[model samples]
Target: MSDSPSSWPDLATLRDRIDDIDRQLQVLINQRAECAQQVAQSKMAAEGDDTHFYRPEREAQVLRQIMERNQGPLSSEEIARLFREIMSSCLALERPIKVAYLGPEGTFTQQAALKHFGHGAISVPMTAIDEVFREVEAGAVDYGVVPVENSTEGVISHTLDSFMDSSLQICGEVVLRIHQHLMVGENSRPDKISTIYSHASSLAQCRKWLDAHYPHAERVAMPSNAEAARKVKGEWHSAAIAGDMAAELYGLTRLAEKIEDTPDNSTRFLIIGRQEVPPSGDDKTSLMVSMRNQPGALFEVLDPFHRHGVDMTRIESRPSHTGVWNYVFFIDFKGHTASSNVQQVLQDIGEKAADLKILGAYPRGVL
Candidate 1:
């Protein structure tokens, strides 16, 4: 809108300088990768084959430092994302990590996995959330990414329930900003759309939007939005409500973009793995505690957290499978389990609660 190609007098000089910088950047990146390889070799030599190269806390710390030291035209998030790819690529040189996510393909969970681990990680799609957990538990994949909650629709019960039965620890978390789109295949006409398909959650998220735009179109629920996109590919009178990844994967064009009722709709995903992450200075701990069906049991259990000065982030209650009226509380708070105050709170809760499980303490989502 402003600068013309011919108007820039120093364009050639700037281009040459950029070329030089690119070369230098390439050299430095390779140097960092070489150093990563050496680190991998040393770890393997000292600890044998079981040496885990992926450290969630370490990566979180590195990315935080990158953002802290950054002074550039690019925003902090943009710069951190660039470094995330570099770290992902370098880690791949040591050992390619396999991540399992809930999907047929092209779901937001898949996108979140890629965002957290980068394109360098090998992402395998699981047909269901439980399958993703199973894959990680069975050692088929190094980690699993599953949606825990959405900003618009509240918590994902399936993910929380899965944690109730699993021994896997949460190693990391990814927060993805969701932008729902109405898409249709080439064979479909926007004016002719008589039906819309999406996951129950996505449909709920876009309820008002769909009502205003396509009032008469029948809304059908699918197992997942990506599946919805796939089912509509050959339908001449159907559209799917999904994200950009699904639209591109199914070769559909967006009829309407960001169609969710909430502009700030986003999803938080938990990274489930076998390993426990260390303290990252800034971290969050999640717990599952069960209490007897007593009147003051709830307050008695939670009072310790308030007394200890530990910041509680979230708490969700589900039926305790062991008893008729008993409940299990899934609690999240700021601070590591290793910290003294957190340990004290846990001890107090342990004395009162029937059972308690420390799900994991993980680095807060960086990007």
Candidate 2:
């Protein structure tokens, strides 16, 4: 297991080469940052008082190119993350934008916002999903991030319903791998843990795992995984199922890791904003279609997508919240609103449906 005499010299040389590479990377990053500043100045001069520096489509295109061109010892995702943070920092130099997410500081939505926007942007915590929407609509924040769906559980109804009334657009999407860990405070002993705290979905996600492991523990549904992590800090015989961010924020000891019943559990979140993001070459469109109470309503609305050759990714139905309108269908399809096939589908559906609202046409998630 020991290195040969010949290998020792190569190891030292490799370390030195790494140092040289780091120096070159530093120079290139700073140059990029300076260029971003120049871009801001150019916009200010050209656009007069209505200067906007952040472009969701532009960033998405850059990241897509980064992934496409990657040839790496590091993974495409690994390299893309490095570029994402670099772009975030450069964007901050242009102008730091504020984002609000559903949180008490360490929730998954906050993690999604940071992942999508990068660490350079200011991310504020909101008490509820509706609050996040209100803040963005009122211009209290530049953007808001909210959970849309989970792989194990179905769609988030609150977020989908929010679209029914709000004017906010879907600027971007972030998919976070959700890892639920069993954790306890310093005062809690591993064997003595008798109760488990987690959000309702977290508890449901880990149901089978909990049955096999901590069968006797009482499972309590908290308002959030963060709130569960917060409460467990003061209780001796209590543990919480939460993600890494919450566990780290609370400084709790992890008793079990990746305890979700489903191995690849993840949640999708959306970036809600005022600006309509242009197509990133790769994109998806979300729409809310209201249909009157009539026979073949579903087939009539969806046939257009099939006829136009538009791929419908998801379709969920909700109550229209009115007596006259019986069905409110939320549809997500593959293509930008700008494309001919997509426009054709919209046009066909517009003639049949009671009302149609284009929620957003946004870049598909990069990471």
Candidate 3:
């Protein structure tokens, strides 16, 4: 009865179909949210606790189930990200989730925060890593995002150090693929470039490219790569090494892209909060321990993990900072604290450790 008997539907009809789908999606979302409210009621009645919001273990279990049952057309990581937003939204209806990250806005940390938590969240940016933890500990923000490690570099020691004494828990993690770009003002010339600016680490990461092309250019290190981009101008004959987000934020043009040392450069970020997340099926537990400065001491700390068949994902050591001639070991393993094998390892560590602390157990990143 329409003008599109043999052809595709008209624009208006197609638009109406989209609207119909939106209505259906809205209804399903509401139903899902109503179920979450019911869950809160059940928890309040059974546990006599009204403040229970995060369930890291339960979240992990859901992701694990999805990953295991995932079929073609959608990768496990993609499916998990979709569910993360769904769950984050369900929790938000009860309380708004506020997160703090190292930012002045538009930093990679900010992007990671948004990626992990959907647009339904409030994000606060701090100047330093310690400030991020401070905001979380003070209850000003619900969570904090800080870079943990990079594929090109090693780890962010400042972040690792902050966790040593902070009480905030690692609720989740988001991994961002870092693509460094050389950005400059629209009127700038590449051949006339004489100065390059960026964070010291970023500059170091792109050392090979800089050395090859900008041998005569003076490299400067700034507080942040974004800040460096902000400093570039039409007459400066300079560029900055920063993420694409920063270039967009500062209205700079990207002269080059993905100029890092390695093609697979990515940064892993941690989401810290006062509340613990329920286990998502795929979980990682992090810990820090102080061991005697003796031979086989490090191996002894690792032995229980091997015995329990737990997979060790990362292990790094830092000078104790508490005293001279002492060190602390930070280890990340593939299991939740609530798991039988992980529990057994922790029990063994309890009996054998000089000093130890479980930083937090969080969902392993997808993609």
Provide the overall lDDT of each model, using Cα atoms, as 2-decimal numbers: 0.94, 0.92, 0.85
Question: Model 2, clash count?
Answer: 0
* Model 1 C-alpha lDDT per residue in residues 167-275, reported as the tens digit of each score: 9999989999999999998889989999999999999999999999999999999999999999999988999999989999999999999999999999999999998
C-alpha RMSD in Å of predicted model 3 compared with the true structure: 3.8
TM-score for each prediction? Answer: 0.97, 0.96, 0.86
Best by lDDT: 1
Worst 10 residues of 3 by lDDT: 49-58
lDDT of residue 290 for candidate 1: 93
What C-alpha lDDT, on a 0 to 100 scale, does residue 193 get in candidate 3?
Answer: 90
Please give the lDDT score for candidate 3.
0.85
For model 2, residues 1-367, the per-residue Cα lDDT tens digits are 3676754658778899999999999999999999999999999999977777888889889988888899988998989999999999999998898999999888999999999999999999999999999999999999999999999997999998888889999998899999999999988998998999999999999999999988999999998999999999989899999999999999998999999988989999999999888888989999999987888999998899888899999999988877654879999989999999999999989998889999999999999
Best by TM-score: 1
lDDT of 2 at 151: 96
